[model samples]
Target: MTPVSAPPIATASITGLVLAGGRGQRMGGADKGLQMLHGKPLAAHVLARLAPQVGVLSISANRNGDAYAALGAPWRAGVLADTLPGFPGPLAGLLAGLRAAQTEWLLTAPCDSPWLPADLAERLTHAALSARADIVTATTTNAAGEVSLHPVFALVRTSLADDLAAFLCAGERKVRAWYARHTAAEVAFADERAFYNINSLQELAELERA
Candidate 1:
């Protein structure tokens, strides 16, 4: 009898998701992603940096999906946010993206964080795979040498969608708390300023001036 060969395993493919679903209450209820940063909408900068790093991309916005669609690169036209009600925060975005993802992995970044690293997806993917972790997040050290995890900036397995959905249904919304339930890895980035996000008018001004 001839011996049977095992099937080849499929390689992982990553899709990018930009989280822009916040109400921007701190920025006076404005659409923060559409707000200006260096003469461009903040999401534009993020899209430019993140588009080249993934196979496909999507955004998560509670409103103004048309404006977000317009900011997508030429090749990425027609891409729009997966709308979810109530703006349950970044986790809702993550869950929506995961459920909608066409790939095995989902890489996420916030729209208001314009200066995200060009290597964000690559590094997070590497860390997760190397550590055999379910999730990998970008981390940065502040001037005081305090390390902080940017939970929204991460590479996550799409397979965790059910688990995340359950977590959310249980009223658990904290990103860190959810990550704690899984095997997670962290990759440190040297630039602390890279993670500086625009949460208010003053913060936007600081980034604009820089």
Candidate 2:
């Protein structure tokens, strides 16, 4: 008998959030998400790739909400600001996304990773359902066969919003630490370049030139 595979998660059941709410110290304090890559904002590139993968789209921007909102206009995406002050980190953004999302799952990716895999949400959702995990993140293996975890590229249940809020209230800012508290699974992708995140103006230039 042929084994039946689990059905793919409905795109409408997941909300996508681009974590653009960073201090951008590496980019000389300039908003990293606003940095242009190939004549478009880096976050714009991310949003373009992410928008089709989920039912709703949102941006986690601490600055330049208007610009982000405009970028999101194509998808009618919501622009969210971190509830916790001082640009707490991606977890804060995750918290905001979780709270605002009407979907069962929230898929997150950093704004600077314009080349994020198109299959990110589908793969993560599959891993989450298979493992019965609360959170699922992406991983990649380097040329040397060293595995690296990309915790920021994750899918989490919106149900964890309260737990995340409490964790942030207690000053726990680490992303991996919060995931450790839950049942988390990791899905490996073959292409490492798909997850590349531009950190500085120099890196953006390098990527553009490449």
Best by lDDT: 2
Give one digit per residue, the lDDT tens place, for model 1 in 1-210. 443222121223878888888899999999999999889999888888787777778888878878887875553523444344577778988998898888888888998888888767767777776799989998888888888989999989999999999999888889999999999999999987788788998888886797
Let me know the TM-score candidate 2 reaches against the reference structure.
Answer: 0.95
Off by over 4 Å in 1: 1-12, 73-84
TM-score per candidate: 0.88, 0.95
Count of backbone collisions within predicted model 1:
0
Q: Write the per-residue lDDT of candidate 2 for residues 46-151, one digit (tens) a residue.
A: 9888887888899998989998888756675589999998988899999999999998999999999989988888788889889999999999999999999999
Q: Lowest-lDDT window of 10 residues in candidate 2?
A: 1-10
In candidate 1 the C-alpha lDDT for residue 110 amounts to 92
- Write down the lDDT that model 2 would get: 0.90
